[model samples]
Target: MRKRKWSSALLAASAIIAAAGCGSDDPGTVSGSEVYDTCTTSIADNVPAFYKTYFRCVTITMSGDTVVIKTDGLPPHNTYYYGSGHDKYVAFDFSKGSDYHPNPNTLKQQNVTIQIPAAPKARGLTINAAAVDAKVNSSSNEYGLGPRGVALDGVSLFNPLAAPGDDIEDEKYTFDPYNAHPTNNGAYHYHTTSKGPLELLKKLGKTTNTTPGQAEIEVYGMMCDGTLLLGCKELDGSAPAAGLDSQNGHVHDIKDKAGTVHFTGRYHTHVCTSIGSHKYTPEIQYYDTCK
Candidate 1:
C-alpha cells in the first residue's frame, strides 16, 4: 500500500528495539533469542474465525538474535470454489494459474514453526493466518444444482436460495468481470486473499514490508452449505445487509492510512440451495482491538 514513515516517537521506540539486536535484514534468519531481547511478545488474547471451530495459537519465541514463530491449526476443508463451481479441488499450486485448488499443506495444520534468519530493523513485519470448518454432504440442500457453467444460467447465482435477481450486480455477472460458479451444491468458497494476512500483521502491531519473504504467511478459510463460517467482503462504507452484523467481518488494511494495501475477501455463494443468498457475513467471535 501507501508508504508510511514512522513518526519520530515511533522511530525512536523502534530504534531502541532494533539496537538491541531485534532488527535484521533477513526475516527468515531471525532467531528466537533476538526476539526475546528486543520485542515484547504476546499472543492474540481472543481467537478469530480461523480458530472458531479449530483451536489455534501463535507463539513468538526469541533466542539471542533469532525470532521463531509457530502457528498450529488445520484447514477447514481440502478443496473449495474455483472461479466457477464447475471445477472441483484442483491441486494446490501457486503456479497452476487457476482460481481454485486444494488447501495448501502449508495451511493444513495449526502448528507452523518458522525460523527466520533475521528480522528487518528499518520496517516492521506482519504475519497473518486463518482457517475454516464445515461438514460436507452431497445430498444436502447446501449443494447447488452443479457448477454454474459460465454465464448466470438458470442455476442459482449468488445464493442458490435467492429468488434470482434479488442481489444481482450487473458488474459482477458480466463477461468482462468473469462470473464465478457455485461449488459442490454448497455455497461458493475459495482461498485466502491478501486481506487476511494484512489484518493478521496489523493485529500484531507490525506494518507490512515488501521485502522478499519479509512479511508473509499462508492464510486459509472455509465455507459450508452456502454459508461462510469465516471471512467477509471488503466494505465500501455502505450499510450491510439486513440482520447481518458488520462487526462479524474482517476489515482490509486496518492500519493503512492511505488505503495502499489492496485486498479483497473471496466470494462464496450458491454452493447450497437453501442458504438464501450471499450477504458478506464473516464470523468473528474474537478479534484484536485496533490501537
Candidate 2:
C-alpha cells in the first residue's frame, strides 16, 4: 500500500473538522508524515492474521526479518485526553471518584514505526550474553518512559516507570479506566491492563468474556524486543501452566484462532493484574537486538 501525502488544504480542513468534532466515515485519506485526523490506512492482507484483526487503521508490512508497523500513536477510542469538542472525546469516568485528576497532557498524532522480529526465538538457559540479563541486570534494561510497545489499537504502551522522583504506585491514581494516560509529550500509552483492546478483540469474536476470567484469552500486544504480551490466560483460554521468569515471561508455541502455530517456541510475557499478579511489561530489555 502506498502512503498518501497530505495537501495543505486537507491539513487545514482536517484541523477545522476535528475541532468541530467530526470525521469522515471513510478513513481520512490525507497523506503526510503524521496522521492528524482519522486513520484511513489499512493493514496489508499479507500481514499476520492476528495483526489484521486487531491493528485496524494502521499499516503493517514485513521488512527483512522484521514486521514494521506504522501508526499515528493515537487512540481510536474515546477519552478525555482527546479534548472537548473532538469527535473521539468523552467525559472522564468519575466512577473512579473525585480523585481522578486528568493529566495535563492531551493526545496528538505521532509518527511511530515499530519493528518487531518476524520470527522470535526462545532465549533458553543460555541467553544473549550481550543483552541485559532480565534476571540479574534488571536495572540496565529497564523500560524507559516512551513507546515500549504498540497496542493492537495503534496506541503506545509505556513502561511502568514513573517520572523522575515519582512512584509508579502513585502514578496509578492518574490512569483512566483503560489503565492508560498520555505522557508530557502527548504520547498516549498503557502500562497495564487495557479494557479497550480487550473489547476490540471481543467485537471481532476472538473471545467472549469481557471481564477477567480463566475463559478469556487475551493477546495484549508485542514489545519492541520481540516479546509477546498476553493477559491472565493463554490463547486457548487456559491459565499459564509454567512459572513466569522475572520479567513475567515464558516460552512456548502460541497458536492462532485456527489453531495454527503463530509463534513457535517463542518468548512472551504476561501482564495480568486482575488475578493478583503484579506483572507488567518488562522495564528491562531481554532480546539481543531491538529497533
Q: How many residue pairs clash in each candidate at the backbone level? A: 51, 6
Worst 10 residues of 1 by lDDT: 148-157
**Residue by residue across 5-124, what tens digits does model 1's lDDT show?**
324554466546645655232221222222221122232223221222111123444444333434332111223233233233433343433443332122122223433222212111
Cα shift from native, residue 83, model 2 (Å)? 0.9
Query: Which runs in model 1 stand beyond 4 Å of their true positions?
Result: 1-57, 73-107, 119-193, 199-291
In candidate 2, list every pair of residues with a backbone clash: 4-31, 5-31, 6-31, 141-284, 142-283, 143-283
Give the TM-scores of the predictions, in the order they appear: 0.21, 0.77
Give lDDT tens digits, candidate 2, residues 13-61.
Answer: 6456645756332223212233323555465545665565455556787
RMSD of 1: 20.3
What lDDT does the true structure give each of the candidates? 0.26, 0.66
Which whole-number lDDT from 0 to 100 does residue 158 have in model 2? Answer: 71
